[model samples]
Target: MTGFPGVRPRRLRALPALRDMVAETSVEARRLILPVFVGEGFTEPRPIASMPGVVQHTLDSLKRTAAEAAGAGLAGVMVFGLPETKDATGSQALAEDGVLTTALREVRAEVGDDCLVMSDVCLDEFTDHGHCGVLTESGVVDNDATLELYGEMAVLHAEAGAHVVGPSGMMDGQVGVIRSALDRAGHHDTVILAYAAKYASAFYGPFREAVNSSLQGDRRTYQQDNRNLRDALREIRLDVEEGADIIMVKPALAYLDVIAAARAICDVPIAAYNISGEYAMVEAAAANGWIDRDGAIDETLTSIRRAGADSILTYWALEYARRGATR
Candidate 1:
């Protein structure tokens, strides 16, 4: 064989140590945040049908799960609530004894500051209509009225000891409203992780089932359209300007490009949500013996990190962390 004249990329590939040393991306337990669901009125964990392995956990189980995640050295746990009751105003969302608020307090007590506790600060779980905010007389989402509710929710979460409040509703000026509310409530140190580029994706199907969502229609009117890249960028920029401590793009796999772009433009950490449908697809395929479950998870998460996500929120976070510990 003729000698290569200008390039010799094979030399680095020939040595495993050299390849490892030069790896462009890596995923670690500390960079992964597990999303957990805690429900009121459930004495045991209730399985979510659409998401085979996921469950709506009772308060006791939720505390244990939070402790386990902290012991595993995972980044944190993002808690979602399923209230026992729902109404037009989502009254329970701001109540101190509400499902999420109570769960936050319990998880914080169990973990004892060992891990970060994040709360999902949206009204969908408590709202009868299953929209992210309160509705007007005409059944339209009232943006200004919703902002006031979001602000109240933020204060409630802060009081409940949430380390971070994830505003995933995609409401206009939500970050500013929540920030001001937290500051006024003497929670100035609390962080805001904005769902800056959340798209109205079909990938959230399993999530809806997990929270027992009764959504009457799609959220396309408020959530970013999947086809609009520029809009995503603009939203991210606006959130950053509005005091978001962390920025996120939901449904990580399909929107890696958006994650990369946001990473390039923003100074704050970028997070990607490896959403429910993504996890369900892997579980379904693995059950069918079409792929190695652990291998598929590692590859999928590695790709998201390589695409510039600083942290990832995934249902597989604990499993992946345990695997990494074994290795």
Candidate 2:
């Protein structure tokens, strides 16, 4: 076994300045993207119990937050909508004046190219059944039909001034459909950040509550299963071939290997989501005095960045960035 010889590695780790100088990965505000939730018709922001410290913002609050995020020098903000109504077809998702669309326009106006404006191009929040797509008569998610809706959603988001439209439904051919739709709609400059490796993980529990999900069944059929890493790579390749400008791996902490693998094979930028459940667990443990909260937050994000994520979507994005991310 080889050692550091005369240049002992232990000495390098002896001081904070040396540690900072030798850091292999950098986690900066420019690489952090905040995930924000906005709902229709609210006087003030509403707290989500499942995800403590996360709130569903009113339009006013959302715009203010967007300005603040820009000021914090964040990479961007990803918007998820909590619609006032739901339907089988998720019609509100395509509404010109819907919660998500309105939020996109307003956020873009507030930030004005200062930061990227991303929107979730999925039906889970708008659909009555809480599935990612419309169901067939036999109750199976219609993959092809769902692709059409995703295309519509992406086009709408692009038109509303989204810098990026993230298709997270995990439906086959979703990226192709969205790309075609956007091209037809003359949104050539819009970026598609495909959720190519989203898994059906237990980590999504807090997210369900955050979105007010009415899911009657599991998403195991469409979402990538936890057991399949090969499938994730395949999906990433497929999404890239289908015109994805960037690709994402959801609930990033548990899938660092996946992120690393994705970076190995992906030419486009790779994004990883630090999901709601992951955030909640840390908060809960911190509240119980089980860990140094700030240290944990810093470590959690650093690990993800080290694993090869070009960008990270985290609930702590705003807080961490505003605090200068000094660890």
In candidate 2, stretches whose alpha carbon ends up further than 4 angstroms from where it belongs are 1-7, 325-327
Instruction: In model 1, state the lDDT of residue 123.
Output: 91
Looking at candidate 2, the ten consecutive residues that score lowest on lDDT are 1-10
Model 1 lDDT at residue 214: 79
- Candidate 1 on 166-266: residue-level lDDT in tens? 99999999999999999999999999999999999989999999999979898988999999888999999999999999999998999999998998899
lDDT of 1 at 149: 93
What does candidate 2's lDDT look like per residue over 1-327, in tens digits? Answer: 567475667888999999989989988999999999998998889999988899999999999998999998999999999999999989899999999999999999999899999999999999999999999999999999999989988988888899999999999999999999999999988999999999999999988988889898899999998888999999999999999999999979999999999999999999999999889999999999999998899999999999999999999999999787454
On the 0 to 100 scale, the lDDT of residue 50 in model 1 is 78
As for candidate 2, its clashing pairs are: none
